[model samples]
Target: MRVLVAGATGVIGRQLCPALVAAGHDVVGLARSAPGADAGLAGVRIVVGDALDRSSIQRAVDEAAPDAVVNMLTAIPPEIDPKRLAEQFTLTNRLRTEGTRNLIAAAGGVERMIAQGLAYAYDPHGDGPANEDAPLWRKPPKPFVPVLAALRELEQSTRDAGGLVLRLGHVYGPGTIYAPDGSLLRQVRAGKMPLVSGGAATFSFSHTVDIASAVVAALDSDEAGVLNVVDDEPARMSEWLPFLARLIGAPQPKTAPAFLARLAVGSWGVAFMSQLRGADNTRAKNALDWKPRYASWRAGFATELGGLAAADAS
Candidate 1:
């Protein structure tokens, strides 16, 4: 298989490109510059392309002439302010809605097409973790409306193109918010992150290594539609926050009232911390014949972040 990967220099791309190569696929990675920056992607042929530009995307796709196309484009900032998540996600929204259309046009001849999606967008009114078929948030906060709309557009377009949408869980592992030096860890250490309104929202986490493995499996399969690629465990914020703090030797997080929390992280953040729903990965595991290496954040945090914290201290 000749696979063309957009956003090849990103955290997931850096991991996915090499995995595809190791699986005996000829990989062509789209980059913003030639001779891509990541040395980890040794075998992937790099081609400069602008995902948002129609002409540039067509040229790159033609140059690569790949058998499959993977859309991994994103523009998330490192230090996120939950209050401004919708504003912060503006570029990422474009990439999903606009850039996705450009790539789909360029990849018309490709045998397989896959794009990233979010698993956590399901309505919070559900009783348990959401399956892929669950209703998405109908009335998201004003800030999240655009983001949710973009996600819907992205998923619809990909399905129309007969492509698979991997609705991934909250991603962790190296170069991610769960990483030793990432923004989330910094906040946790600084006591800036708190348990908002008892943090009732449930979170389903996926490590980068597991996410890459799932992408590889998706490429090898003929299945199409959406699948939630998450770990086996779904933990609440209240359950995970204190555990993470204790594991990383950080101060116990304080609980903030909903109104007070809103002033800091906005309504969207309050909902995220208190009302968000976790996703069910049963379909993905059954379809892709895959399972995450770290099936629970409890174990993942103990081994990954805990070890890293120990190393940094030593």
Candidate 2:
């Protein structure tokens, strides 16, 4: 299969493009700038294109002439301030909504399509693990409402285009926030990442590699719908934060009262740490015949947790 991957130089995209090549698919990587040497896109072809520009996307798609197109466009920042979480995704929101529409329009003839979505946006009214059917948070902190709207637009349009939406969990792996040198790690090390109201919010995590594999499986399959691409264990902030701190030898996470936390991290941050829901991967597993390699974040973190210690020793 000839596959064109937008955002092909990004975190998951860097890994996904290589995986597609390894799977014997002809892969074309779409990036606004020339892919740097570190992109490691040895066997793949790179096309320069701006995702939000419909004409540019059309030109790239025309040049690549792919049988399938994988839309991985996002502009999430290196470090997210929970206080201004929605603001951080301003460009990402555009990419998800506008960029997605561009890709679908450009991919007029290509039938096989898959786009990245988020598994962490479910409404907090219900139980722990939300499935594809669960409604998105009906109302959120005012700023976050647009973020949800963009995703809803992305999902609806992708499905309408007969594409599969892989709603991923909190992405973590070598190059992500969980990475040793990443800003989130630094925040934890500095004792700035506090637990909100005992940190009851559930979090579903997805490793970069695991998310890539799920995409590959989705590309191989013929069906189209929503699937929560997460690991087997849906964990809570209370459970994972301390474990991570210990793993990195960071100071124990401090607990913040609801009102105080809201003052510090804003209503969104407080709710994120206290009321956000996790997602279930059962449907992705059964539908795509896919399962995450790191079935639990515990095992995944254990292997990669030493970077801080190693950095300290160095």
- Pairs in steric clash, model 2: none
Q: Ten-residue segment with the worst summed lDDT in candidate 2?
A: 305-314
RMSD of each: 1.2, 1.2
- How much does candidate 2 score in TM-score? 0.97
lDDT of 1 at 157: 93
Q: Give the Cα lDDT of each candidate.
A: 0.90, 0.90
Candidate 2 per-residue lDDT over residues 1-314, each given as its tens digit? 99999999889998898899998899999999897787788998999989889999889889999999999999988888877877898999999999999989988979699999989889989966999999989898776888999999999999999999999998998779888878889999999988888999999999999999998888889879889999999998999999999888888999889998888788888888898899999989999999889999998888778556666757
Model 1 TM: 0.97
lDDT of 1 by residue, 86-115 (tens): 889999999999999999999896899999
**Structural similarity to truth (TM-score) of each candidate:** 0.97, 0.97
Off by over 4 Å in 2: 310-314
> Predicted candidate 2: what Cα RMSD to the true structure?
1.2
